[model samples]
Target chain A: MAEAEQVKVLRFWASPWSFRVELALKLKGVPHEKVEEDLANKSPLLLASNPIHKKIPVLLHNGKAIPESLIILEYIDETWTDNPILPKAPHERGMARFWSRFIDDKCVGACWMSCWTEGETQQMFMEQARACLRILDDELGGRRFFGGESIGLVDISASFFALWLGVLQEVAGISLINGDEFPNLCRWIEGFVASDVVTECLPPRDKLLAVFQSKKQAILATKSMVY
Target chain B: MAEAEQVKVLRFWASPWSFRVELALKLKGVPHEKVEEDLANKSPLLLASNPIHKKIPVLLHNGKAIPESLIILEYIDETWTDNPILPKAPHERGMARFWSRFIDDKCVGACWMSCWTEGETQQMFMEQARACLRILDDELGGRRFFGGESIGLVDISASFFALWLGVLQEVAGISLINGDEFPNLCRWIEGFVASDVVTECLPPRDKLLAVFQSKKQAILATKSMVY
Candidate 1:
C-alpha cells in the first residue's frame, strides 16, 4: 500500500485568498493539517515555504511547497483528479481560467477599495465593483452556478462574492449585489453556500463578520487621522 | 485529412504580451494569421473578440477567441503538444506557473517603473528590479535557459527580459542586467535570441527603441509641465 501524502496549508483566518485554498482542499476531499498564521507576526515555516511573496496561503504537500491561491488550487486539482474543480475540455478550461483571472484582476481590489474609501472615491470604486459584479452576474446567466450545476474553478475563485459579500457590504456600508439587481449571482451564491463540501469548510460567517468589522474600524481610524 | 485549425492573433506591434503568443505559435510550428492593431485606434475585431478587457493579444482559434497572454500560451501548448512549453510532471508545471506569475506580478511593472522614474524612486525600483532578476538568475544557475538546454514556459514567459530589456533600458537610461551582475541571465539572453523560432518572430529592436524613445520624451514633457 502507498503511504498517504502529507499535506498542510499555512493560512491567515480572515483572508479570502487563504479561504480559496481551503475550499479547494475540502472540495477535493484532500485531508490535510492547517497552520493558522498571524499576519502581524508570520511564522518561520510560512516565511521559509513562501519566501518570495511571504504571503498566505502556501500549500505544503509531500515536502514541496506551492504558493499563490490559484496555483495551489491547480495543484490540488491535478493531484486529486477526482471532484475536478476545473473543466475538462481545453476551451472550457481556458474560459474558466479567463474568468478566474478576470475576477482577480478586475474585481478583488475594487471590492476591497470600495470598502476603504469615502465620498466620490468610494462611490467611484463602488460603481466599478458593481460593474464587475454585473459582468459576473451576466456570465452566471440562468445557470445554477458558474460551472453549470456544480461549483467549479470560477465559482470557487469568486467565492468571496458569495461568502464575504454581506460582511464586506455591511462593514463598508455599500451594497453592490441586491437580489433584484444581480439575480443570477444571488441565486448562485445561495447554491454555493448550501453545497455540501462548501458548508463543511466555510469559516464561521459571524467570526468572519467580526474580523471585517474590526478592519473597518481600523480603516475609519486611519482615515480620521489623515483628515 | 481533417481541416486545419484556423488560428489568428490580434496584437499590437510592441506588446511583450503579444510576443508571448507569437513565440508559442512559432515554437509549436502552428501556422496562423497576424492582425496588427493600432492601439490608439483598436480594431473592431480586437474589441469584439475581447470585449471585457478590450486588450490586445487575443488569440482567435477556429472563431473562438482566447484573451490574456499566459492563458493563450497554455492553450497553444495544449492544442499543439509537439514542442511542449509546460513540463509534463504536475509539480514542475506548478513551479513554472508560479514563476511566470511572479514575473508578471512583481517584475514587469518594476522593470518599467525603474525606467520612467528618476533619483531615489528610480534607484529604488532599479534595486527591486535587480533583486527580481537576481532571483531569476539564481533560478537559471548555470543552465542555458530557464527550462535548461532549450527554452520552455519560464523562458518564454520571461521573453521580455531577453528582447525588451535593451530597448527599455536604453530608452529609460537604466541598466538592470550586465555581465557581472546577472551573469546567468546575460548568458540566457544570448541563447534565447539565437534560437531560430524566437528570432523569426522578434520585433525589430531598432523600431521598438524608437517607439519607447518617443514615449520617454512625452513623459519628460508631461513631468516638466506638472512641475
Candidate 2:
C-alpha cells in the first residue's frame, strides 16, 4: 500500500545533543535510520538541513528537517501522539518548557565551562554550576525523575547532565556531583541512565571518556604550541 | 455564578521581555492586569512567582505563574486556543521555535552588547549581530512577516528588533538596520510596529529613548570612575 514514512537523524556519535534525539525516537518507538556525520567535515546533507546553526542532531521526517534537539523532541512528540514526552495540562507543559530552557540557559553552560576552565574562572563557573544544581535538586525534590515516573522533556533536555557531564568532569580531573553534596541529582542520574531507553541509546562510558581525554590533551598541546 | 478568570502580568514598562507577553495577550484578546515592578526593588509577588529566574514578564493565570516570555507565549496560545500565534503544522512550529530561540541565543546578546561596548569589542559584537541579521534577512526574503501575512511566534519573539534595537542604536550612535543592508527586515519592522495592537502596547518612543539614554550615561559614568 503506502510506502513507509521516511525518518532519519543526522547525528555525531559522541555528542550528547545527538544522543538526545536518538533517545527521544526510541522512547516514542519511532522507527528511523541514522546517518552518522564526521563533524570536522560536516556532510552536505547536515549543512543543508540545518544551515542556520550547522549543527546536529536534525530530525528528518519525510524530507522535512527539524534542527535543535529540544525543538526536535517537541516535534517528535507532536507528530507521534503515543508515549507523550510532555505533560498534558497547559500549565504543566509551560513549567516543563521553562525548566528545559533553564537547563540549557543556566546549567549546561556553567557546568560545561567549569570543566573546561582553570583558576578563578573555573572556580566562578564551578560556583555558578553548583547554584544551578542546587536549584535543580530542589526542583527535582523526591520525584523518580524530573518528568515524574517516566523521563520527559526536562530529562531529555538534561541528558547532558545524566551522562556527559560526569564523563567531562572525569576527563577534566574535577568532581562536580557526589552523593554528599547532590544526593537527589546523583540518584536521578543513576535512575535515568539505568532506564531501558536511555541505557540503549547512551554511548559506552569508557569510549566517551577516551574521546574527551584525547580532546583535552589536544587543547594542552595547542596551548603549548602558542606559548 | 463563578467569578471571571483573573489574568495578570508582572512587568517592567521599559522591558521588551514584558512587552512580548502583553502583546500576545492583546493579540489573543485575553484580558490581563499589569502589575508593574520597580527594577531597583522587585516586589515579593514577583519574587515568589518566579523564584527560579526572579525576572520580569511572569504570567499569572488564576494564580498559576508562568515565567520566561517565550514559554509564556506558548502557554497563552495553548490555554486560550484562539488567534494562534504559532503555525498549524508541526514542522512550521519547530522552525518558529528554532528561529525564536536563535534570536534570543545569538542575535539579542550580540546586538545588545554591540551597543553597550566600544572599540575592538564593539566591532566584534557588531559583526556578529550583522551576520545574524543577514541570515534572518535571507530567511525573510519576500515574506511580509516572519509568520507570513500575519504576526506569529517569530515576529513576536523578535519584538526587540522592531522597536527597542532601533532606539538603542540611535542612543549609542550606531546604525545596524537601514534600507540597503536589511531592506526586508526594515520593512518587517515598519509593518510590525504599525500594527494596531503593537502600536497600542509599545512604550512611548520618547520615554524609551530617555530611559536608555540615562542608562547609557550611568554605564559611561561607572566606566570613567573605574578608569
Candidate 3:
C-alpha cells in the first residue's frame, strides 16, 4: 500500500477566511500546498471542491474536499493533534466553540455598512455590529489575546476582524474598531500584528486596503449609475 | 456535599427547540423539572437563561443556564450518556454537526427568505423552507429516521422541521412540503408522529397552530403599523 497524499488548500489571497485557515495550518505545523484562487474566474478545482459554497479556503485532504473555512480549521486541529486548538475539558471546548460560532454569527454573517440602501438600515446594522465588537472587547478585557496570553484558535479565527474591519471602517468612512474604546481588544490586535508567527503569515494590510478601496469604488460607481 | 443537584429545564409549550431538549432528557431518562414560560411576558429566569436571544428552550442544568438550542442539545447529550446523540468518531460527529449547522445556516436561519419584503418574501421563504424539507426527505429516503431506523440525536434535533414548518407555511399562506413531492419526508413525519414515545410527548397540532396564529398575527400587526 502506498502512503496517503498530503492535504492541499485552495484559497483566495484577499479573503480573510483564507488567511485564518493558513494561520491554523501554520500553527499546527501542517505542511500543505496552497493554491491561490482568482475569484473573477474561479478555478475548476475550486468550484469542484466546494460546489455549494463556491468560495475559497477549500482544503483538499487526501483528495476529499472540506469546504467552509471553520470546518477546515477543525479538520486541521483534529488531524494534526500536536498543537491543540480546543480545550481538554468538554465544557471548555464547548465554550471555545461558543465564541467561534459567535464570531460566525455576529461578525461574519451580518453586514453593517455594505449594501445598506438607507442611512437608517445601514446605521442600525452598523451600531449592532459595533455592539457585537463591544462584547468582544469586554470578553477580551485585560487579556493579551482571546486565548489569554498566546494566540489561540478564537484569535486565529477572528484575524479578519483585526485586518478587514479596520480597512472597512476606512472605506465606509466610519470607525468601529477604535483602540481607545476597546482597550483590551485593541491591545490584542497590536499583539497579534507584532507576533512573529502572525506577522509573517499575514497578508499586507496596504494590499487589503487597496482591495477594499477598489470594491467600494466599484459599488459607488454602480450605485451612481443605478440611481 | 450531596453530589450536586440535578438540572431543570425552562421551556415554552409550543416551542420545537423546547421539545428537542425534552426528548433528549426523556431518552436519557434524566430527571428534570419543566418551567413553562409566558411568551407574552417572558419570565426573569427565561431572560437570565438566554439574554441574547431572550427566547425559550433554555436548559438549566446544575443551575447554569445554557442558551442556544443546539448548544443546549449538545449539553444535554453530554451531561447524560444513557443514549449518546453524537457519535464517538470525530468524522461522523463532524458530519452530524455539519448537517445540523447546515440546517441552521440555510433553513433555520431563514437565510434566503429573510431578504425579501412582503408578498415575495412570504413566497420565497416558503419555497426555500420547502426545498429544505425536500432535502431532508431525500436524506430520509427509505429510512425510518435521520439517524437511520431508530431516531438518534440528529433525528431529535431535526424533528421541528416536520411540524413547525407546516405550521409556518400555513401561517404565511404558502404551500411547500407538498406531501406528494416529498413522500419520504411525509412518511418520516408520520413515523415520528406514530412513535408512541414522541406522539405522547408532542403538543396538539391545533394548540400549536393557535400559538403560531397568534405569533404570526402579532408580527403582521406590528409590521403593518411600521409601514
Candidate 3 segments exceeding 4 Å error? A109-118, A219-227, B1-4, B109-118, B171-173, B222-227
On lDDT, the stronger of 2 and 3 is 2
Question: Runs in model 2 with CA error above 4 Å?
Answer: A219-227, B220-227
Per-candidate TM equals 0.95, 0.96, 0.87
Candidate 3 lDDT by residue in tens digits, B1-227: 67866677788877787888888787787878889888778898888767766777877767777777777777776667777887666555655666676677776645224322367776676667666766667766798887776777677877666677677667666556667898987888888878876886787888887776766656555532100
Taking the tens digit of each residue's C-alpha lDDT, what string does model 3 give over A45-159? 9888776557888888778777777777767777778878766554555566667778878875444343323478767776777777787888788878787666777898788
Model 1 pairs whose backbones collide:
none
Stretches of candidate 1 above 4 Å error?
A219-227, B219-227
Most accurate candidate by lDDT: 2
Per-residue alpha-carbon lDDT of model 2 for A1-227, expressed as tens digits? 99899999999888888998999899999988999998779999999999988888999999999999899999999999899999999999999999998998899888888887789998999999999999998899899999999999999998988888898888888999887888899999999999999998899999988887878866444431100
* lDDT (10s digit) by residue, model 2, range B1-227: 99999999999999999999999999999999999999778899999999987889999999999999999999999999999999999999999999999998999888888887899999998999999999899888999999999999999999999989999899989998787999999999989999999999999999999888878877555532100
